[model samples]
Target: MAKRPGLGRGLDALLSSAGKKQEGEEAERDLKQVPIEQIRRGKYQPRIHIRPEALQELADSIRAQGLVQPVVLRPVDDGYELIAGERRWRAAQMAGLHEIPAVIRDIPDQAAAAMALIENIQREDLNAMEEAQAIHRLIEEFGLTHQQAAEAVGRSRTAVSNLLRLLDLEEAVKAMVDEGQLEMGHARALLALKGEQQVEAARQVVKKALSVRQTEALVKRLQAGADKPGKKPAAARNPDVLRLEEDLSERIGAPVRIDYDRRGKGRLVIEYNSLDELDGILERIR
Candidate 1:
């Protein structure tokens, strides 16, 4: 497949190039002055939380230095819809600006949605739940296959599948993930249970501040109890080994498992769902 233009560029370049045009076989970004009041929040924006203090800080910066980067917008029936830089738009409004600098593009709905999702992913702005919801929206609303959606966001198919799996989480548990109460690994482990069991396990995980490894163990115990009537509980792992697993998992951004014995001979394992994630883990180790 041919590589898409501006896919590898960082957020700023992507935002600028979102409105790129070809004139005599040369491409250039054109900036415009758009009325602040006429711009509307984008339908595909992935970020759900914008901190008040951070918004104020950006507003202050705009008030002093002006908006250094222009926002990306596309034409809509009522007015221009924001394609990227919702933060800058909100801050410009907070700074009492009548007009904001913007790059106007005439793109279809799928293009706009993909651009919005790409911008947030590049910026690392969306939490796991928000990102999953955004990816799910992109796939469902546009009828894009997992591979197509993965290509749109520059993610592996496995990575995209894992994110979509997060959506299967019960709404209350999903809220916890969205609110930063649970990490991705914790949520993934909780997926082993269903209904009230899953929700209750999530609460217990949060209330006790359990690590990912511990959360997995909790899920296992719960599953065992529900599945087997008289099965013996597994022996507890050494606390030190458990801590090491948690620490390694935290450092590598993937699940880690360790096996230990009386002779101090054991194995260490790190689990990754996709090649991209495996690459990330390897990089972190190096």
Candidate 2:
């Protein structure tokens, strides 16, 4: 076993000893330096794709100051297997190092997977979809429920649930989120629609570079305008009056529009379908 650098305080804590140990046995595993080829990739990599540019940057750093923290690994038939720090392992190879530092732990499969996912989230290396899939796995494969998953990841139940809902978005929209074209806010707003409508809204969000607020307004207008299916509401010069039209339409069960000119004046127009509906509005108002 060879001495290795500490992983600052936070990541070191994430890897603290956790399994049953014999009486009087050492709880901490000794850090070791092992041949890079002998260390196999982990059972599952939460981050499937590593950006070459980022790996090269880390490699350059390793070449200069060396790997600040050793990768965590476990024993396998051939040699050792990665438990965490896939990025560091890949970068070391890019740095053309023959052997890298490691700490070998005997972690249970479920716990090992959880550790990998948690480390990736901490590094902000996982995209939204990858995060969701990892969380889903911790629930399904490990028989963990919502509360358990939340606790495992140190996130609020609501945050976890909201992130899971992102999976419900159309794959196209999700791809946008994963690729960083549309952020979580945009995905959340797009959730207001469904099927092709939601997908189209996501496209508009990216194409127009609309703010979250603007996207919400667009969704509302689209939904409210769906009564006539394809009819476009005429533009109202006064936005304040336009909002009034929406409010009146919702309140009165009819399409309403307000037209206004220069100085805060307008005509409120309400359309009614049947005589009975007209009578209903008259009775409600009077």
Candidate 3:
């Protein structure tokens, strides 16, 4: 047969050379794979929150792919300690893998925790509460300042500050986010309230589908009540309370209030912008 112009000696020679080089590299390749049991869970894992649904999805992926990448770990007193890939390891166990691949390295506990936290944050794999907890752990456990932790996570100080503030929200509201019923915006809106008011506002937010601005307006209304004379302690009132006359005022759609005397005895003044609100209050009392 006649030699093909493109597929003759030159092409054959090039393919043979490339194949030999690949084989040589493969022969030199060294990857140490360890058993699943040999690698234990890390003592300082960064992930504070793991959604059960997410874990189930990870388990499914593990079943399909059989762990494509080895988990990173360090040698410990027991066997090996995981430095990262905790979720993968957990899912692998759920997937019933006999042995998982892991790469062992020597690193300090603090460094390992920081690495794990930074990895998760960069991946955006953590929820708001978990992110806040991670940042808090970096500050509390690792002795890092808020600014330092913010820098470590590649977030602005205000962003970190605001996220941490969410931690102060009612647990019910936090559960809402955990259950994926509410977003951070909703939580932020509720955070503007205090104590039971936060829970109440959260309920209203969900029930009324209130926008953030509307929620904020409700919060301001509640705050204005606190600012009114005789509504709050007499010690805290400003001159504006007097300028407004009556213990409280009601503009269109404004909140109604009833102020009592400091001695706990006085006329019960009811201020309402509309007849509907007046009737609504009366109906509730009756």
Candidate 4:
């Protein structure tokens, strides 16, 4: 006992010092250094789309105030991959920044996809098409189920399903959406039709500058016509359908379509290009 010579006290001192060093090491590890050029866009990005005007505005903001928040990134082979704040990154580039501050993470591709989708959805940065695409990517790329993706994006599985349905529209219709001419509601209405009918209805809604109701009515008419025998309604088969759809599509910034049957059963199809449009439709329906 006498020979112990305060060994316990010495050990206690050593342990306390080790604890402090460990804490200091952890704090140092938490510090991040991110390179600007190394920050590249992720393969499974959250934002499926962006508006030029919005980007321009963001550029202006970055030019004036600088990026308020640093972007998040993960290490990759060629460069640091973006995790969030894509808009900010794009704007930073526009603002002529050479290097950007970022927090480095070790997230897996699936986790990154999930995080990005959630970030975009929470910020309302993604349009309907973009959101749909993100959800699709999460499912396809990350092997997430529709329910899992929906949970990540804080949307219902049905809502995710409907968005995916929008992708089935004609390229022209999808182009209208990407261009911000047609909304998702307009697209949904158009989806009621098959092949050429979808395109035809989309044309009418745009040209006629039809209201959502009008578009829905036209879609209903076309659906009914399809169900009934004989020729379709004049409105459904109207030559002006395309022009009308274009006009309305341009006016409302959403795709529009009119559906009519020879039996006079008619419905107008209004396609929404974005989640905002879908939200508006939901509000109206509610």
Residue 285: error of model 4 in Å? 18
The candidate with the higher TM-score, 3 or 4, is 4
Runs of candidate 2 exceeding 4 Å displacement: 1-18, 22-28, 226-229, 234-286
Question: lDDT tens digits, residues 39-91, model 2?
Answer: 98888667866778888999999989888899988777898888789999999
In model 3, which regions exceed 4 Å deviation? 1-31, 207-211, 226-286
Model 1 TM: 0.69
Counting clashing residue pairs in each candidate, in order, gives 0, 0, 0, 58
Against the true structure, whose lDDT is highest?
1
RMSD of each: 6.5, 13.4, 19.7, 15.1
lDDT of 4 by residue, 27-99 (tens): 4326364667888897767665688789989989988987778887877898889878899999889888888
Weakest lDDT window of 10 consecutive positions for candidate 3: 246-255
**lDDT for predicted candidate 3 compared with the true structure:** 0.64
Comparing 2 with 4 on lDDT, the higher-scoring candidate is 2
Residues 1-286, model 3: lDDT tens digits: 1222332233234334534544555422334566788877777775666778888998999899788877877778878888778888888988988788776555555556666666676657777877777777666655544445567778965466657767788888888766656676677656657787778777877788887656755665666675345785324433454334322322221223345567756454444333433543454456
lDDT by residue (tens digit), candidate 1, 142-220 = 5555556677687866566667768878999999999989998899888768999999999999999999878998987
- The per-residue C-alpha lDDT of model 4 at residue 208 equals 83
- Show the lowest summed lDDT stretch of 10 residues, model 1: 20-29
Model 3 TM-score on a 0 to 1 scale: 0.61
